[model samples]
Target chain A: MGRSPMNREDTTKNRILAAAGPIFAQRGFQQATVREICDAADVNLASINYYFGDKQQLYIDSVILAREQRAQQFPFPSWSDDTLPEVKLRKFVGMLLKRVVVMQTIPWQVQLLMREILNPTEACRQLVEDYFRPIFDRLLRIVDELAEQPLTDLRRTQIGFSIIGQCLHYRFSAGVISLMVQEDQREECFDWDELTHHITEFSLAAIRNLGSHVAVKSSPRTSETH
Target chain B: MGRSPMNREDTTKNRILAAAGPIFAQRGFQQATVREICDAADVNLASINYYFGDKQQLYIDSVILAREQRAQQFPFPSWSDDTLPEVKLRKFVGMLLKRVVVMQTIPWQVQLLMREILNPTEACRQLVEDYFRPIFDRLLRIVDELAEQPLTDLRRTQIGFSIIGQCLHYRFSAGVISLMVQEDQREECFDWDELTHHITEFSLAAIRNLGSHVAVKSSPRTSETH
Candidate 1:
């Protein structure tokens, strides 16, 4: 009885979000209008106010929804305690590559997030706190297990960034890389699974050797001859 | 006496380029105007036509000049046969870091090149051929010296990109990283020297151990438990 109206309300909100996501993704916040979103959703203009309160809220929700949809589609597989850090790392890196980079089509959310990276707003700050912080924490946990012993937060963050940097490079430099790679090797170069393997193995080798055997000098910059 | 005309022409052209580079960097190619470039150069607007012939030629010359200046500044040391691969690798990576990432103020040339990245044109293609291809080849030579056996082009490229990816991540994600790093460790986090050291060591460890001891499997993707 009471739940019926609530479910209807939920449906309308979701419909508005689905319509608004791509519009907001394509056009920035100021440019994306409530009328367009309502028209796209096939609802009247009042529906935008009724469902989302305002256009700004609609934009924020769309960005959040974009992240949530991907998180749902490619959720991380649950790993037990006995799982090797190496295996955990491989899975984590592979999932990030898949979610962010390896997709056949660039998700509207990615474009939306790219917009945020350029012009960070309140939503971007919230995203950092809610979404990215958790992922960063997850990476730190995995890196902790790989350390020879308990490592400093800085070292852990560096190792995590190293792993992340490799993954992100593929996404950012895809254009330049395409131009640089020979035509014959382009197929292998773009294959997500092959790339994941390479990045994983490369990072694993670095992590395993880093703390145990790194030959630090008095000043690393001074050692450079060039 | 013939050289006098050439010298005068060179000085005026250099002046125009010096002014135009920053304006193009600040305002992208489409928006940047020849009049503004000339005004900043303290030369009449006609000087743009007289020195570079056209706006397009001026933009191209500015892009090329950006690359040339950096090349001259951080040119790789001529290593002797006796220099260890470790030392060579350190210097190569360090020089790259110095050139791209480790700077007090990002040279406008960097911003100008960044514009090329977003909207590539003739200048970008020339950049890849004349500037980047040679750097890539140099990286291959360093990696070759470190390898146990002669590596394939793909392998060498992957290795080189891994190093480059680590370096570039800092520049592209500077804002996100600033937000992410904790307050107490902020200084070290942003320190270019410290960053260069970490990246160089992490990469060297990976390169040294990668082919020699990377335990290969029949199917790497299938081996992940998660």
Candidate 2:
């Protein structure tokens, strides 16, 4: 009976976070209210303060939860010493595309995380070293293996961003693309399998070519600065 | 003084459209008010409709003006028949990256057009046929010239998007990127010249490889559909 009070507290906190994610995503932190979140969770007004300490803390927790849930759903596969970086890249893009798009109605948690990344709040400063840096580090390593010649740090970082930029474009530019592209054309590229395959092949082909071409182009002075 | 009335009317209309561009861009079509725009221009309340017909028409004109001003400032360079498509592509990307990112405080017009693309409104459907279609056609042609072999329409379209997507990401993902990339590393990729060079090289490499690699991977049935 004593432990049940603690269990109830846990349930209430979780419920508040569940309700807060969509509201924050929809309205943004500046506009979303604690009252609205409490209303959505069907909890007492005082429960949020008692559980998470404050609204900002609740928002940060919601962002973390969104990231954590996606991580579990599409957990990174273990790679052996023999696994090809190209293959790892394809798998990585596939997972990211799945998280970013594909679903008819995107899950709220995914939207919240995507929004956080787009206009990151104070939460991101704290989270990036822990979350984004490691993921970014993994991407850079994959790009490193794909390149045959030694890439300067800045050049390698650009390539990493180029691959990610392609994926992000599909998610953020849907409205623009829809107006520009024919419906049939949209289906062909936007299809989950087709997009993953295209991004992987495009990045691979570029990666294979970058070593010889860009090394001559990148100035030593600039590269050394970075 | 018969002509003075016509000139005054022209000035008022121009003033309203100029004022509306930033307001609509900042607040978006749904949130921005005609009252705010009138106040900004320091014109009477009735002057808006008298000049532009209605708020919707006013919003559309603001979008068109934004596109036109950027076009005039950064007019596409004319190419001779012998000019290589790769050169053309590089020039094209350079101009675009300039419009999208290089300006210190992105001119209000540029921001308005970008917002229109991301969450297109009634203005887009009308503008797409006249404005966007020609630009898109030019991009597809550039890719067509660069491709050594025949590409299916869907394939060509995807390639076009891949180039445009890379450019769009740099504009939209600045906050996320700033958090992930170090300040020193950012200058290497983000300096106007550096980004244009990287995108062109990356896209060209991918285009050169596409004929052999993607043709085999693209199913005949899917390619035939579009």
Candidate 3:
């Protein structure tokens, strides 16, 4: 059977979104024009207005679409009920790093999300709630299990931010990081497994120390008498 | 002897640099124009070329000038030789948060540095070496003192990155974070004292646990058989 009218409209919409993602990512919301998106998508100018109503709506949809596409392509690893929390945490960190740094198949989605982060537009709140909050909750659950004591919400939030901050640093400051370290060491630090291991171990050590059983020995180097 | 020729030239150079700092910070390097800077400085068109050679050099000088100005204005807290490493780390994290988040006296410098970080230009290398390297070294030294065992260069680097990452997150993602959490919680989090305290404790705990004496307990909640 031939494609129905609704199918043709959906195809047109998908084409526009596909074209708009990269253009919006590259030029940002202000610089990116509907004309350019339409031209890139090879659709008529009316088609954009007809399908998306306006540029702002188009942008919001594009961001959501990018999130959906990335989630589908590189879904978070599934862990069975028997899996250890530490193992799950490790996998979570690795999945984050891989999706962010290694998955080159959808570079625009990452870039768009990052740009939204650095200079968020109206769409940012939706992006955060829809895309980031779920992942953050997942991380918090894993951290809660790993912690020796029941963590306060504030402490849990701080711990979650710490883990995410480490992952994001590699993406934002990869250039500066490479520049700061020696050439030989850059590969080792940036290597997917190495960075993931470092973050997991660092976080785990800290979480374990939060327990009352562990006495955090004061530095011997401290000259002040306690 | 009124203003000498050399003194007059220096004043003109200073004016251009001051005017350019905000413009470059506001508009970034590419969008910021020489004419606007010259106008803002109330100098002749040719003065930019005469003083700083060109727009690119002028941008570099302005960044350097902003760095020097900020450093002088809000110098990092100096620790006495007898100061405890834990205290030093707390002070370090506090100083960083104050400079990045609370110090409203010179907002442009932070914005300019952040813009450079997101979309680094040719000046990024110089920025990293001249500004970041010294701070990184200081942090490494502090972390070294805190750790019970001697950290490898890679571990030290990772530790330094972890600390810096936590501090930087508040500045960059403050908007998203505020949106993520409840309104009442926002004040507690963005409170300079609270954020600094959280980061310091979190990092210190992690560093202390890295010692050989501390046994990292496996997650009690894990159901998996090891």
Q: In terms of DockQ, which candidate is strongest? A: 1
What is the alpha-carbon lDDT for the whole of candidate 2?
0.78
Q: lDDT for each of the candidates?
A: 0.77, 0.78, 0.79
Return whichever of 1 and 3 wins on DockQ: 1
lDDT per residue as tens, model 2, B1-226: 6444553365777788778999987676767888899999989899988877888888888898888887788776578899899888987787778878734566787778777776577777766787667777888999999998888887788788889889878887776777777777766567877888888889998888767666657543322112
TM-score of 2: 0.84
Candidate 1 residue lDDT tens string, A1-226: 6344553464667788888888887666767788888888888889888767888888888888887777888787568899988888889988888877735566777768756654467788787887777888898899889877777777788888888888877776666777778888877786777777888888988887886786333464555644
Instruction: Report, to 2 decimal places, the DockQ of model 1.
Output: 0.38
Query: Which residue pairs show backbone clashes in model 1?
Result: none
* Model 3 CA deviation exceeding 4 Å by range: A1-16, A30-58, A102-106, A213-226, B1-13, B30-55, B102-106, B213-226
Sorted by TM-score (best first), the order is 2, 3, 1
Where model 2 places Cα greater than 4 Å from the true spot, the runs are A1-13, A27-39, A43-61, A218-226, B1-13, B27-40, B43-60, B218-226
TM-score of chain B of 3: 0.83
lDDT of 2 at B4: 49
Backbone clash pairs for candidate 2 read none
Give a tens-digit lDDT track for model 2, residues A52-148: 8998899888898888878778776557778889888887787778778736666787667766765568777766787667777888988888889
Model 3 DockQ (Cα-based): 0.36
Docking quality band of candidate 3, CAPRI definitions? acceptable
